[model samples]
Target: MSDFQPAGDGSGLRVDLLAIADLIEPSSRVLDIGCGDGELLHFLSGSKDVDGRGVELSQAGVNACVSRGLSVVQGDADADLANYPEQAFDYVVLSQTLQATRNPRQVLLELVRIGRRAIVTFPNFGNWRIRWRLMAGGRMPMMGNPGEYWYETPNIHPCTIRDFVVLCRDLGLSIEHQRVLDGAGKAQTVRIGGSWANLFGGQGLFMLRRP
Candidate 1:
């Protein structure tokens, strides 16, 4: 980890975000979509020596990021990204926010178009806890960070690691690396994920590149 400490109260960065940053090459330009308060971008810029910028729709999120001297734009992921030419950045990141987008595939294509590589992370809807909750209790599983009332949930495209891999195959995106996080965001016990791990892993992160 870089010596640069996060600006705000130590909510600390999310483990998944840290994991993604760990894979990034030093001095890369990064664009973080749905950047929230720019915590990850700040860390990347200050600690990892990355040139980082963000796009966030929430006014409060943008303001908070700006207050910390971060560069962020107010924009929606669903909109066109024509302003950015092909491969304008070394990396484009969409962490734990892909499921909330109006169109996941389109947004992903744009990310790859605007950057040489993309990192995406999201909750695994196929986790065993979620499956058991639905099977045994007949209820949508409330698990980990995604635990929230059904009516108020932000996830619109709940899917598993396998699902994402399949989507990548179908969309012609090449996945360079993948990682699954346990409930604590630590590496899961299972290393080789397939059908079994896909149904049990809590969250997943992917590093992708255009074919």
Candidate 2:
């Protein structure tokens, strides 16, 4: 097992979110798409002093964010991203929610159009463990809860780290920075966008900007 530990400042951010937070500058405008419970936003607001706004699809999540004094709205990324003005915020974050979107390419285009930079994180379907499991069991690999079946999972367009890198290139988005985490959420030293990273990385985090 990887000897990775989750990073937090008593605000309870996932390791991926902590990596995302590190890319953001202080006192900048941020729009977090699918900001569940505003945990990352709350962390950013407290630690980085950002003007954070969030859009969550679930009303329960929005309500929870509001309860924590966060500015969040209930909205869908597939349809609502088109309504935003061009370059409206300093950063736009879509963490682990890209696979669930109906039109990921269009959503990515809109993310760059609406914000100066975009931070995206997703589970790497090309991880060796996932591949090994599928080959050994002859079934879809379960990255999260093993009890949850494939049909019940929310991931529709789950892509590998290599797939994501190619998509960014095709979308004309420059990868400003990237981090690949091992199974235990530890940042790896492997070269970004390389085949080794794709095979070994359990999750991928990318900071993208339009060139």
Candidate 3:
């Protein structure tokens, strides 16, 4: 049986974020890159007593996080991450934001360098829904939202789960743990490293560390 648990109902977090929280240890020092409105940081701070900090690109998002009393700064993951020293935090998280980074490889390197471990989550371009839509309609795929057009989407470096795994291997990063999520962002009971998961999983969640 899979150890993945269903995200708590009404946890005031997106299912994916909730799952990420579960992967964290209580009282840890955390840095949430591309934290958006600091939802994960806030939740971790309150529930897990984590000493949470955040970096968000959007000014509005920084404002929102600051208003919520989260220790967040306005910064870009692509460039600003280099300023952090090695092993500065217990965990560094990038959730659903990898595809949007200008240089994902550099950002990922920075993640593992700055934290003992890194937690990453992103929509899987290899999901069957995306593949079907692209093959059938011959247009760029959309993830259940008709309003989001291909050109307008922020995902510039869209990648499949397999691509991510290969990148991690190439970078010499160890996969501490990994899980697949279903359409509702709930963790699924599937072999996350298998082809079946690449075909059916809606998203990929990973815990990574350097060797």
* lDDT, candidates in the order shown: 0.81, 0.87, 0.89
TM-score of 3: 0.94
Higher-scoring candidate on lDDT, 1 or 3:
3
lDDT of 1 by residue, 68-150 (tens): 99999888788846577899999999887888888898988998999999999888888887788899998776643444766
TM-score of each: 0.89, 0.93, 0.94
Q: Global lDDT for candidate 1?
A: 0.81
Worst 10 residues of 2 by lDDT: 1-10
lDDT score of residue 144 within candidate 2:
53
lDDT of 2 at 187: 76
Q: By descending TM-score, how would the candidates be arranged?
A: 3, 2, 1
RMSD in angstroms between candidate 2 and the native structure over all alpha carbons: 2.4
* Total backbone collisions for each predicted model: 0, 0, 0
Give the higher-TM-score candidate: 2 or 3: 3
Give residue 84's error in model 2 in angstroms. 0.7
lDDT of 2 by residue, 80-118 (tens): 988899999999999888988888899989999999999
